[model samples]
Target: MTDFAVAIRVYYEDTDFSGVVYHARYLHFFERGRTEALRACGVRHCELLQRAEPLVFAVRKMTVEWLAPARIDDLIEVRTRFVETRGARFLLEQEIRREGRLLARADVEAACMNRDGRPRRLPADVAGRLAARVRDETSRARSTGD
Candidate 1:
């Protein structure tokens, strides 16, 4: 799960009058990327919600940079990495690229919360799974001198 990527085609609706993607549209792409990345880790939102004590992830903070524009009809890949997982929160780094060229980047912090909207620590198993991904990626990077 080092860098899970989901390919997305820029649709006409995702762009503005000039055919360039609207700044806000990148957020949608990033969100989709994060969702898919979690799914790749075998963490599905529906499963979390179905637990006896339901939980959901909410974005707590995000910082983004729009390095370049993605125009309609372009095929872009959203790469997401789960960098850290703590008590009730996790951090993600994401990038939108077109053919290996960076287009935008975002750093996000997401909190796990109960249905009542109060923060709740991630289920132990869930946390362990995410932490394992971080560890695996780190060890691999070190071995490869990345």
Candidate 2:
């Protein structure tokens, strides 16, 4: 199981007039986290696109909780974990943290879709690799009692 962590700095453009990160910025952070996570697992999105079965993943649902405000210039870490993968969809748990404190959390459900935008099953090999990462992450969490 593989989990990925990406560090991002809140920029002035990511904030509102009050200098705090805007709500939408969290979604962007999560997107980057997911992309990096896949890359770390040796699954490049571009390569996926070039496959014979060429497919992409799209968010089916997202539930987010804002715990604290993040200000511009703050170094934030986006942690992404593949929580589950089944059938035609996968669930991801992502969080935004600053100095070990969770600033926001999101539960995302994503579906694999073909170029025509219809739901598709993930290739067996791809799913197996993703499942391995999920299992590893779960084991690490259990070991840490988290």
Candidate 3:
């Protein structure tokens, strides 16, 4: 939808000796963003695994840019946009920001996979739901100029 956002508070464990969030920790933040976004669309990972043909998602590729730093205790928002789905894969764009200031961003490609690790087309029902959510949000955003 417009962009699913989740607020997070930076913790000491997320920071390095320099008192800034460690680069790799940003990945974790982005992951949480993605998970929450899916949840917002009524898709839950646990439910996916319980389907008739169990399914899971795996990251195929990602590109990230770190534009600024977030220090311990800083509150940040992770915003995720589900770009599109292609074959067995889906694309997402995520940004980490603090008080409207861009901190980092990531573009992700993820694939749906069977338990055996072979790529599989996303379940039709799941894809439909995601598509509907995207469409609804797009219209909402357009109407509000968000």
Report the Cα lDDT for residue 140, model 3.
80
TM agreement with the true structure for every prediction: 0.97, 0.95, 0.92
lDDT of 1 by residue, 22-111 (tens): 999999999999999999999999999999999999999999999989999999999998899999999999999999999999999999
Displacement of the residue 95 alpha carbon in candidate 2, Å? 0.6
- State the lDDT of candidate 3 residue by residue for 1-146, as single tens digits: 33789999999999999889999999999999999999988889999999888999999999999999999999999999987877898888889999999999999998999999999998888788777766776788789987
Ranking by lDDT: 1, 2, 3
Q: Against the true structure, candidate 1 has what lDDT?
A: 0.93
Query: What's every prediction's RMSD, in angstroms?
Result: 1.2, 1.6, 1.6
Of 1 and 2, the candidate ahead on TM-score is 1
Candidate 3 backbone collisions, by pair: none
Against the unseen true structure, what C-alpha lDDT does each candidate score? 0.93, 0.90, 0.90
Worst 10 residues of 3 by lDDT: 129-138
lDDT, candidate 3, residue 15?
A: 100
